[model samples]
Target: MKNEVQVKGKFHYRLIGWKYSIWVRLLLFLLLALIFYMSLYVKLVPQVYDIQLGAVSEKTIYAPRQIENAVATEQAKEDAAKRVQPVYRVVNLKNDALIDAIYDKLLQINVDEEVKFDDKVSIYRRVIPQLISELENQSVKTLRNSGQYNDSLLEQIQQGLAEQQYQLPEEAFFKLPRLTKEDLTAMLPVTKDIVSKLMNDQILDAQTARAKVAELVNTSNLTKNTSRELVTEIVRAVITPNKFFDQKGTDDARGQARESVKPVYINKNDVLVNVGDVITEEIYARLDNLELLKDKANHLPQLGLAILAALLSFVVFMFVRQSTLPITYNNSQLVMLILIFLINVAGMKIISLGQNMDYPYIGYLAPMALGSILITILLDAPLAFISSVLFSLMASIIFNTEHMLLFDFRYGLVSLVICFVAVFTIQRASQRATILKAGLMISFFSMLTITAMMLMEDQFSQKEAIMSLSFAAAGGLLTVVFVIGLLPFFEVAFGILSPLKLVELSNPNHPLLRKLLTETPGTYHHSVMVGNLSEAAAESIGADGLLCRVGSYYHDIGKTKRPSYFIENQTNIENPHDRIDPNLSKSIIVAHPRDGVEMLKDFKMPKPIRDIAEQHHGTTLLHFFYHKAVKQAEEEGADNGIREEDFRYPGPKAQSKEAAIVGIADSVEAAVRSLRNPTLEQIDSMVHKIIKSRLDDGQFNECDLTLKELDTIAKTLNETLLGIFHSRIEYPSELASKKTGT
Candidate 1:
């Protein structure tokens, strides 16, 4: 027997070998990063302007980036700090001691009964002056030691104390001696209480304290005029300004006020100096601070953009590496992904160039969904989802006019909505027109997203809103155009069998499918049954059911060459293999898979369909032919050189879950169809038995199908076959029924 058929295309063969090479993948990722960097280079670098202070008659200048206006922020903070009032601390001044001393002196003078009354009155008057002087001295010392008052404050304190001192009238002094020792004691507490109360309150001056002293004395327990007057005078002399400026506390409060102020920012695209307006020193400084001034070169923006590009590339690379899809690991598929990425980024860059115009919403015109639509059609939906996110991020950056701003939420949001809409709408696309439908869906969703974004703004413009909606709708149509136009190139270049291509191949009018139906109708019917079983089983395990169905349709295209040789097409005809040697029959049986592969390649079918055709038999033995050869050798008592290996189909076993499922379905369909009246139990047993045989033969080793998925496939096939060959209920004979009725 010949070796396994090699049906790989020239381009596929060249790149397929490098799929697993780490160096090749790294280079491909580098290329992706390079595309990102180049596309964003213009937006990343700040635009430089030539202007000087006092210059006039120039075009309007908009801020190229969002930057903190340090000068303005500092000025605002200073203003906030100045708005805070000065903090003051209150001192207690020890008024209780001063009042006690004055009372003790007066009591001492009154107790001198040996002296003349007039002379004692003179002594009381003299002691009153001494006590008042002592009170003033003590207040000055206390105020100085409080650490809150300066020398100027201390002088003010002295002046306030001097003005508050009671002037002792000659009659009042004589009356002071008339008070008894008990009266003096009562008055002492009244004086101390009034002074302490007044000092505890914030006293900025002695005049304020003196005004309240008379009222405080009258309200006290002392009813005698002499005692009240003495208490009032004493209280006034002791009270001085205790509240002083707290420099440290005031500074701290101001500092907090400054800290609480938020920094002022110059928003992106904010007008710096409009046309015909002079560029003052302030305006020139602002431009310099934003790094938009000429002769100021900043490479940080470029370096940052490069880092972002590398990050996006890494995310994509990691996602592809971790994906279980067979095509994800193919170098050709990676190249296709790179090309799609470049095209999308380039479109965004081109659209961003319009930002230089007066229209800021021109970014809405970018066909952001183009890449996602193409990816969903050519690759898996999950991969397309991830690519959509990355594309939105790139669009945000590319469309951003602000050099310092990494992303614009408006662009990112709209791009994300359209990309997701495209992916979901086109995920199950079956026809070429489905791409247009996806575009329309994307367009509708884009308009909704744009409208919602515009409504969120503080200002709304009817004209701008209409323009943005128009751009969004046009963007969707453009996406459809690009997807439809570019799909054929990707399909032919990489030999990827996308869903749309599969749909076209599944058509009955295709040259190969038509030949199978016309030349080998029986085989074609068998293929259709296999397709039904394979599709159901594949769908049960989350595999590509469409690929399985379409692959099954053409899996036996080679049987068209010699339809009578196959049992399915041998309707009412003699078995041709009965006359031929079993070995020759084995060759013919095994040759069909190879012949099918060659026929598929000549027809220029995608690699996956051809792979299904080539691997569906998976080196399975020609059981009937092998056994016949064995029996013939046993009867002749001679060695016929019959090896089980030679009787087997030459196969590179199923390389994917879809191929493995198709193989299992192909076997189970033929077996169940051969049964005359397969009961539900027999059909179920047959499905499990064929699967178990394939498992034991190691046919599923190359694919990722687990034993669990195989069980699921078995269960699905059983149900499908029962539905296909359901039995009807039996009825009694008409003659017996009529006799019983008579």
Candidate 2:
């Protein structure tokens, strides 16, 4: 038998093919660049202003963008340095030694017996001046050479004494009674006690030490006031400041203080100068850093942004090229992907314009989840996940607050989490209602993410937290609304056969399906069985079982156009082909697939369903009609020139796994339905036969089905068919007769 198949014209296919060529690729790249560059231009390039410090501006100059407040940062450093306390070292050891020597000399002079009272007075007066000089010299020497003596304190005390013109009377020194050993010993204890206490304490100045010495002398039980006065003078002369300033340590502490202070930031869009406000030096500097006070040309930031956008676009392109979905390779899909990303970015930008408002967290209201949900529905989850990440990155920057460094991770983090949640929960959405369900998931996740971010900020407030959570939840719902509104548009404009759309088309209430069911019930039942078989077979091979099942349900839609011409729809009626010409019968049989395709197109069904209806028969031969025509031609002894090619249906073959599996299932179901109570063995044999015939005919050549997968499909179809057409056991004859009699 000749295998005749009609070809669908290749004009659109050729056009699509040409779009993937080198020049077309470059044009697509250019288009992407233009879009990205435009999106980023205002953001990256700092808005320039030529106003100088103290200049009256023609218009109000707002801060172009955020930058470091150099002046404020420096002031913070200075304040930190000033807050560092000066360092000091203990230097009290030398003070004790100097006091001891002075005491010994006084004791020696007092104990002497060789001199008269008058001579003793002169000697005491001379010795007293010399001892005071010695004490002063020793203290000053220690202050200069060691860390123990505070020179400033010592000098301060000496200057006070010189200004007072303090002169110990000769009578006070000479009038001291000749002391016994006990007296000298008592004096020694007194001297040692006072000096030790004063030296151990942190004395930065000499006035305190002198005051302590005077208090001690006044409290002492002295025989004479003059003696007490001479002792007080000696004690005051010896006392000095022990705590000395440590310049190196103090400087190091100041350095550390400077290092500890964080650099202050000047927020983006911070008012540089209000309307009619004079420009200050600080405002000028801020504008200069933002490149608003422009004298120098700056293009690096713009170029860098361009490169970043290009890299991001390239990564998205590569991901789509290597993704698991076959539809991603279509140029329309690529265009849609880019357009979706740009639209999401545009939304972010529009919302970001108000980031400077009092409600800083208003950026949380952006519907970033829209992109993830749409991508998940239109494409696959992996692409949706990737798009979610990219959209989050864009959100972080676009929705960034001036207080944030670089990008605001709060927005990015929340967007990423919520978007991923949307993608994960709705990856297999099969109904328009599922989008609403996914929206609820997104809302819950967004609120949760917002709460987490607020808690992390360590600045969570009840009112602000509630506001943020509400906004996030609202944003999620808005995303759902946007997705629901845009989904049908994308489906129609791009001819995307989304799972939701497929589910819609698969409804029995659909016009085409209703027609098939009413006018061609036999074909309808056959299509239903085919759907079951194809679904099972598809699942076995990791194909889209839903698509296969749905495609199978509508695969024989064309049979409804000429319901009586097909055997399945003819039911118990006489065969129409008996009186009709064989060529006419062949023509009717061949016309159905095309007729179904046209009907589907007229109804504006998605392309995948139409394709399945058009390609389910593929190029398989109409063996019965061809053979009957040959036999008649031979019986009549005519030319017998009946061509086998004329008996085949017009076919583009099965172009996808779903379509191919549906085709195989359609044939198997029709073959099995013709049997009278088929046994499991007969069902298995028929299933294998149908699959082998199609495989041998190269019907699966266009799709990606492997040999192993084909075997799996055959085994799966066998099991499904056996279950549907299982043999019933006959009851025993005696049991059947007894039941009937009873």
The best candidate in terms of TM-score: 2
Stretches off by above 4 angstroms in model 1 are 1-17, 49-293, 326-329, 356-359, 402-406, 728-742
Model 2 lDDT, residue 538, Cα: 96
Best by lDDT: 1
Error of 2 at 40 (Å): 4.3
Clashing pairs in 1: none
* lDDT string, candidate 2, 126-153, tens digits: 7656765666566566566765434564
Weakest ten-residue segment in model 1 by summed lDDT? 5-14
TM-score for candidate 1, please give it.
0.63
Measure candidate 2: CA RMSD.
28.0
Give the clashing pairs for model 2. 2-644, 2-645, 4-645, 91-148
Candidate 2 segments whose C-alpha is farther than 4 A from its true place: 1-18, 30-45, 52-298, 327-329, 726-742
